[model samples]
Target chain A: MTIDFKQDILAPVATDFATMDTFINEGITSKVALVMAVSKHVVEAGGKRMRPIMCLLAAKACGTEDLEKHRKLAAIIEMLHTATLVHDDVVDESGLRRGRPTANATWNNQTAVLVGDFLISRAFDLLVDLENMVLLKDFSTGTCEIAEGEVLQLQSQHQPDTTEATYLDIIHGKTSRLFELATEGSAILSGKDQYREPLKRYAGHFGNAFQIIDDILDYTSDAETLGKNIGDDLMEGKPTLPLISALQNTVGDDHDLIRKSIATGGTSDLDKIIQIVQNSGALDYCRKRATEETHTAIQALHELPNSQYRLALEKLALLALNRIQ
Target chain B: MTIDFKQDILAPVATDFATMDTFINEGITSKVALVMAVSKHVVEAGGKRMRPIMCLLAAKACGTEDLEKHRKLAAIIEMLHTATLVHDDVVDESGLRRGRPTANATWNNQTAVLVGDFLISRAFDLLVDLENMVLLKDFSTGTCEIAEGEVLQLQSQHQPDTTEATYLDIIHGKTSRLFELATEGSAILSGKDQYREPLKRYAGHFGNAFQIIDDILDYTSDAETLGKNIGDDLMEGKPTLPLISALQNTVGDDHDLIRKSIATGGTSDLDKIIQIVQNSGALDYCRKRATEETHTAIQALHELPNSQYRLALEKLALLALNRIQ
Candidate 1:
């Protein structure tokens, strides 16, 4: 079931993604300097451009002749993603993102939120030209699902009773849905149903695995490679799956300490709690779960025809898993 | 034309808008606690519910038979507005809105942003039920326009070079587009073309006057009526039309001081500058401009058939003009 992967898709896709940012710029008619500053700052700061790459790769994989449409869609996805990030930074009260001061932190929260909104709105406008009503429905639904996921995560924050299923629901809403839609949407746009379902499933599983690994890295990664402070989740009071798993498996004072640490969300005792979780094999357990999901993710690609895109996607899943360790 | 403006339309619209908070409970699958908390916090907080009310009133003015659709649309508009606010508060670093601790301030920025995204997504879900592709298109476009407006506003924050035309463009993007959409969307949803164009113009002008009045109120309105500290915008360094126009009208050191105030955002000499602006007749000038817009707004409604909703809308315009004073 392994597919051949290549980085060529990466370069052209990256280029197109760069070009897609233009769509966001096209209808922005305001003379607001801060809007331009924050928007340009966020976009140019550079993310993996994962969503747009998925759009282009999916479109190419589906054997679509029109790269232009895919390029536009890809840009819209990135804009949407960036918009969410601007908003997310504010939500997290994050001062830094992708190694720079966040829009909210750098300018103010109002601009960040509004700029994010502007981007989200622009994404829809970009998609409007594609002339597919169903795509609108799918994208709109994805936007909402992402939001619901965020709310789910927020609700579950600092609650010891938060379950694995609830966590899964949150991940699905916040991360996997958008990932799944990126490929699914590309396939839909290409009018190629043959590869659509499999591509979507593969992307979804990969996204789930990806976010799990991200959560793991939050515990395990150094600041240099990760580009963010390790244990930021803990500091922010987010009880990731690994932490929750450890809490559930603990006994006596271990359980008491875990509960208090999570409740306090990184007091002086946070170091001790991190050690307890590390020793408790929660990290190992979650990492194993992520590995299993990664395996399942690769399996999800079985229906897609062998191609560089398919292989690259499989490699992507593996890279995500390996990156956590 | 004077139209009969009824409290029934507004009252029930407000009630339904209020009830939407509990509607999240209907999403039985997610973390109910989070949903309840986010929804309750957002809904219970005071808002003008202007967009939704516009939708309702527009429908009523058009003599639409199906108030139910308009009602749902109203809820959707409010939800969208709420979502933006959730994100906006985080971006603005605003601690209070309408005299209540903002969602971002009360919960955390992350929760506020995510919850806002969730509500936005939920809005699309509601829009989907309306089952009109055009409505979705309209809403989606409006969403983008709002974002563009926001970005424009952000970009314009400190640039004293912003002209009247530029100012109008920013205001239209930031505020009026939604207002116009709300009125016209209601008419469109209700299939009332006769009122649609006129109602849209009415809403646009009204919203323009409304925002100008708000900008003027920043200097003139006391903390109690404005529900925020006076000159908060000035402190934030947001150069609204009053300042921009005043700067353009004044000469020499007065202009230089105002420009510097805009750049430094009224930090030092806040009172002295406020005095200078007042003495320079900026407040009076802005008020006069707002009143002019208000008159034009009222004039736009002349084409609508005599109805209570139309009159309420007209009164709303007048109220907007007079509120700051």
Candidate 2:
């Protein structure tokens, strides 16, 4: 069955979501006018607030009543997400995000970079206020891994020899780790130690599936539908799953073409690459892998007592998978 | 009395300084090859290690014999400083810092931005290991302010209406705040609550004096002496104290020229603006202000008992002031 996001997923925690949204606005307030302005611009440009919703869902899934702290944690998660996106846009030289002008485009790279730093520091500042040492340690170490993941992605750029294992490491760092933080952190804050591993596993696999679907879209989705063009990843020589899988399945000319495309990034061979990516069964293999990850993620959810929040999270994972279908 | 940096300033904590330097190398260890390579390059390129030295001296001044924790704190301070410098190079688009290639130059902006982020997270990760909540709060809050200060400086860039008070706020955030962190963090780590405020004040004022002297040298010092070109700040339309003071001391043609130079950044008017800035008595005014700030920084040191460490701290402040003389 098709799922409506607001009704099926966000509806259960809609009030907490609203509170968290407001808190994000309140949290980003800075004495510096430029910081406040740039931060407001980027945070407002956020998409769906998926990570925070996951945090709230995990909190409720743990059967916790008092969500005052979770709401703040959700806002902090979004802030960290927004901060990373700001830097990512600067790194990617992206002009627009979700149809809005990016922080770098709105002001300049300097403003974007510094404001991103402000958001990170502010996020940590608020985290310190949570007064939970365990949460602090998790976040501190998680952010480091997240950064290492990003640098690794950069290091892998234009290299065609990157492996599936390396690709998993990349997605885990760049995509899934923050998701784990959102859910596991909720478990930590809720004082539910037992739920931590399951939630982390659920988020990790879900994050991996989510990123795989995104990389899949980069080779398939139209700009109007996805807000980013097809071949965008290939254009940067980013050896995402599709390109990596395509290399593995093809041989002779097809293999050489994929390697050349990754080595010399551009969309000049876009149509040809897309046709090969599909014809060679890379997309099917990618879809199967994503489905398997989604299944594993859903399976991990069974560790928690069955509830509406858990079902909503399960539905959230399914909704992500449905995008490929 | 000529203050020999080695004998007068670093002499008291020379052994500790050497240990702290080793800690920085050890502290920057990363699993990622690129993170390690870039981090090592920047940390090794660091000059004088002023902030960490201040941290070591402050710990000694507090009569803490076990310099173990203090050494780690000192290393953390340098890491934080290095992180900012990495980002600052990206913001300023600087190629070389202290006559060595910047991270941004050695790698790329994307690498620099990400590695800079890794450094920040690593610093906090190590900080969490310190197990001092007070120290953590100070650093988290201080980093936010530092970022805001950077944004504030960017906001004021080329505006020409930036006041001395606003300028002080900028320097306090961008420059002095870290210095404050280095010294105050020492007090926090040493379990010496009484020394925290005094150390923060001393460092704050000393930072102001040092930056002011640096700004003055922007119009005075040659490339060989300062390792930077003259009028570099004016080239960026930075309305530092010299230009602010120049505006105060001139009118009509001179005032208009300085204002235009600030509003429209470039080195085309370099000689003309330099001549106007010097002849307008702005340099003398800036010198007086730097001297006043140095005196206040020294006065704050009186709160600590007289010891070789305190004397070294005093000498450090004086040595910074002597740069202008």
Candidate 3:
């Protein structure tokens, strides 16, 4: 059965979602016109507000009644996410995100880079106002790790020798680490110390699964469905999971092809690379791994008490997994 | 009197400066090789470490003998400065800083942007360890303003109508804000509440004078002397103080020439524009403004107690003004 996002997941926290969304708009208000303009453009281009929703859901799952602080935290999470995307576009040199012109495209790399910095600083500024030292420490360190993860991914770029363990490290930093912060940060704000670990675990595994699925789609999905063209990662020479797994499963020309493709990025061998990544059972291994991660993530959610919020969180994980199936 | 940097300014805090410099080296240690490499290159390429030296001087002026926490604060200030420079090079698309290859030049814009981000996060992480909420709030707010200042400058780019008031706002956000943070942060760390406002005022004015002098030098100094080419700002169509002052003082052909130069950036009429700027008394106006700012900065220092550290701070401000002479 197909699980509808609004009905099965986001329904429970719809009010909080609206509140958080409003808070984000208010939070990005700046004295500088350009900062506000670029921030609005990128924030509006946001897809689904998944991280903030996860934050709200985790807050509710912790049995917190006062979500006013959680709403602010959710807004901070979204701003951080938006800031990274603004920079990521500059790094990736992409013009469109979610079918809209990116900040880099709308203005220039200078504006995009500086505005991204503004968003990050503004996010931290708001986080400081939360007046929670524990939460501040969490975000301060978490953001550092997030940056290191990004740099690590850059270092790993075009290096075909990158391992699965290294790949996990890359994905954890680039994608899952923020998700961990969203849920873990909510638990911190809720004053639910006991829930922090389990929430972090659930989000971390869920993030891993989510990114793996995204990487898979890079090899499989067409532009019409994914908004990203096929072989996009290979084009960039990014040694993502499909390429890594394909290298492990193949030999001779297939192995050399995957390695060369990673070492020398481009979509010149797009069809053959896609064909090998599919026929070599690499997609099957990746799907199985994604499913395992999702299962672990949902299992961690069991640590919290039964509630509609918890159910929604579980459904969210399952829904992500369903994309692959 | 010739104010030698090492003898007149850095001498008082020489030992503390040494310790603080080492802390910066150790503080930037990263698990990611590229992060470390790029961070080390840029941090090592730093010139005079003026901001940190000011931080150290301010802490010493507070009559704080321990000098331990102040060292860390100074290091944090330098890291923040380095981070901005890294991002600034990317924004300006600069090839060299202080005659050394920029991170963007050495690696790529992508590396520079991400590494700069890592530096910012690491700086905040270290600040969090300082465990001063008031200081954290100051820095968080200060960084946001710095970014806004940068965006404001970008917004005013190539616009001939930009006023001195707008120029002040841009310099305050981009330049003075960090100086304010450095000295004010030192006061905050020194636990000297009474000195915070005065220190902030002093640094704010000093930063303005420094930027104005730098802008003036853009028209007067060349690559061999200043390490920056003459007309570099004009090449980018930056509406700096000299151009603003030139526009204010001229009219008819002279005014139109300056305005056109600003509106359409290039060094095509470099000789003519330089001749106009000098003959139009724009340089005299900028010098007078810089001197006035420096005097106000020195006046603010009167609030502090009489000490050698305070003397060094005064000398530092005077030494900056001496550059144009």
Candidate 3 per-residue C-alpha lDDT over A96-129 given as tens digits, one digit per residue, 9 for 90 to 100: 8888999999899999999999999999999999
Candidate 1 residue lDDT tens string, A1-325? 2322235447535566567667656644444565667778888775777777777877877767667888778777777778878777876778888778888788877777777776776677667667777777788778777877777777777777778888888888778988888899999888887877888888888888888888877766352453577777877677788788888778999888867666777756666777778888998888898988888878977777777777666677786676765
Candidate 1 lDDT tens digits, B1-325: 2322335335534554455434433432334466668667876684666677777777877877557677777777777777777766765788988888988788877677667766776777777777776677777787877776766766777777777887888788778888887888888888777777788888888888888887877776462464567788888778887788778678888889888888877567667667778878887888888888888888988898888777777776765555765
DockQ of 1: 0.51
Point out the higher-scoring one by DockQ: 1 or 2.
2
Looking at model 1 chain A, report the run of 10 residues with the lowest lDDT sum: A1-10
Sort the candidates on DockQ, descending order.
Answer: 2, 3, 1
**Candidates in order, interface RMSD in Å:** 2.7, 0.5, 0.6
DockQ of each: 0.51, 0.91, 0.90
Put down candidate 3 lDDT per residue, B1-325, tens digits, no spaces. 6999999999999999999999999999788899999999999998999999999999988888998999999999999999999999999999988888999999999999999999999999999999999999999999999999999999999999999999999999999999999999999998999999999999999999999998999999542443588889999999999889988888899899888888899999889999999988999999999999999999999999999999999999999988899
lDDT of 2 by residue, B77-120 (tens): 99999999999999999998988889999899999999999999
| TM-scores of chain B, in order | 0.90, 0.98, 0.98
lDDT of each: 0.74, 0.94, 0.93
